[model samples]
Target: MAFVRVAALSQLPEGGALGVEAAGRRIAVARVDGEVYAFADNCSHRDFPLSHGEVDAAARTITCEWHGAAFCLLTGEPTCAPAFRPIAIYPAKVEDGAVWVEIADEPAPAEKAGGLRSLGI
Candidate 1:
């Protein structure tokens, strides 16, 4: 795994999220209750950018502005209907006042033999 620095801890305000692109992937970095969370920036419902949506800090959910789908910030699970698919969640850690994400290596062909074979490893 490789850790990619996306932003500083102070860059994201509480109840707010920042859109970042790293290694050719769009990611949403959110800060809530003094903690930070990261997920794929696109909404599972309609492929909309979740970073443009509203963050409900109290509920720990992000509401997609395009279709009203709500997703849990902690787990990236859809809390509302019309979005049965979950967004890909990434592991985030803070070091030296900077936020870094753990990126998984590309899977081997045998390891992705199932439907995951389409993952393009």
Candidate 2:
């Protein structure tokens, strides 16, 4: 896995979350008390975008608006009910006013399914 630029630090307001695409997957980036955290964008409960939720910088939690599920921004663990599974978390860092997140590369579906490219020519 390698760190990839996602957004400008200025664009992420204090106690805010943003959904962005990285490594062909949706990632949720949240700003809490000046630090940035990145995790899977979808909620474990109902597949809702966590970016639409409210963030509590002090508690380091994001409350999903869809079903009132709160999750720790730092650990991606559910802090409240309706969601028991933890979302996948990624290492996030800021460099020169830009936010970068480390995401693991996953094989494409076709490749996983033995597409033509997989043929031993």
Candidate 3:
């Protein structure tokens, strides 16, 4: 697994989320308070793109528009229902004016230990 460039940092709007594909995985990249975060684009409760939702920069949350589910940008943990499951979060960074996301070849170490849903993430 390696860091893959998804989008130019300039292309990502402040206080918003952008959908990108990395290693064939749908990802949502968000910029909040000058920091970037990446997570699965799909909502856990429904098959909706998180990028199509609203971002609360101050609260550090992204809300799914389809069902009003909100998830933390940092931890990908659901802050509101109808979502009880947390989304998968990936490592991300901005360098050389580009947004880079680290995609794992296999399940992440944490995922291997207890699986994503089993660990509540």
Candidate 4:
């Protein structure tokens, strides 16, 4: 895994999320009560960008603005209908006041190993 710098910690406010692209992948980085979580930017329901969604700090969930789908921020699990599949999640770390994301050199299979096959990649 290679750690790619995404943004400065100060740039992201608590209870907010930032969308970043690294290695051709979109990542949603959120800060909740001083902790950071990272997930694939697209919502599993409609392929909408999760960064455009709302972040619920207390519930630790991200609600898609497009289709009302809600997903757990910490685990990226879909908690509502219309989105039975969970989004992909990545490991993140903060060091020296900067956010770094661990991106695999080779893209890993999607959250469900064979699930993306239908996409005809």
Backbone clashes, each candidate? 0, 0, 0, 0
lDDT of 4 by residue, 1-121 (tens): 8888999999888888899998888888998888888888888776778888899999999998987989998677789977777787788889999989888876545545532222321
Question: What is the lDDT of every predicted structure here?
Answer: 0.76, 0.80, 0.83, 0.81
Model 4 TM-score relative to the real fold: 0.87
Better of 2 and 3 by TM-score: 3
Ranked by lDDT from best down, the candidates are: 3, 4, 2, 1
* Candidate 2 residue lDDT tens string, 18-116: 999988877889998778998878777777888999998889999988889898987777898877777777889999999999877864332233321
Judge candidate 1 against the unseen true structure and give its global Cα lDDT, from 0 to 1.
0.76
State, as a TM-score between 0 and 1, how close model 2 is to the true structure. 0.85
Please provide the root mean square deviation of candidate 1 (C-alpha atoms, Å).
Answer: 5.2
Worst 10 residues of 1 by lDDT: 112-121
**RMSD of each candidate?**
5.2, 8.5, 3.6, 3.1
lDDT per residue for candidate 3 within 1-121, as digits (tens), equals 8999999999899998899987877888999887999988888776588999999988999999888989988787889878777788889999999999998998554334332332233
Candidate 1 ranges beyond 4 A from true positions: 107-121
**TM per prediction:** 0.82, 0.85, 0.87, 0.87
What would the TM-score be for candidate 3 when compared with the true structure?
0.87
Question: Which of candidates 2 and 4 reaches a greater lDDT?
Answer: 4
Output the better candidate (2/3) by lDDT: 3
Candidate 1 lDDT tens digits, 1-121: 7889999888888889889987777788888887778887877766778888889989999898887888888777789877766777778877899888766676322223321112221
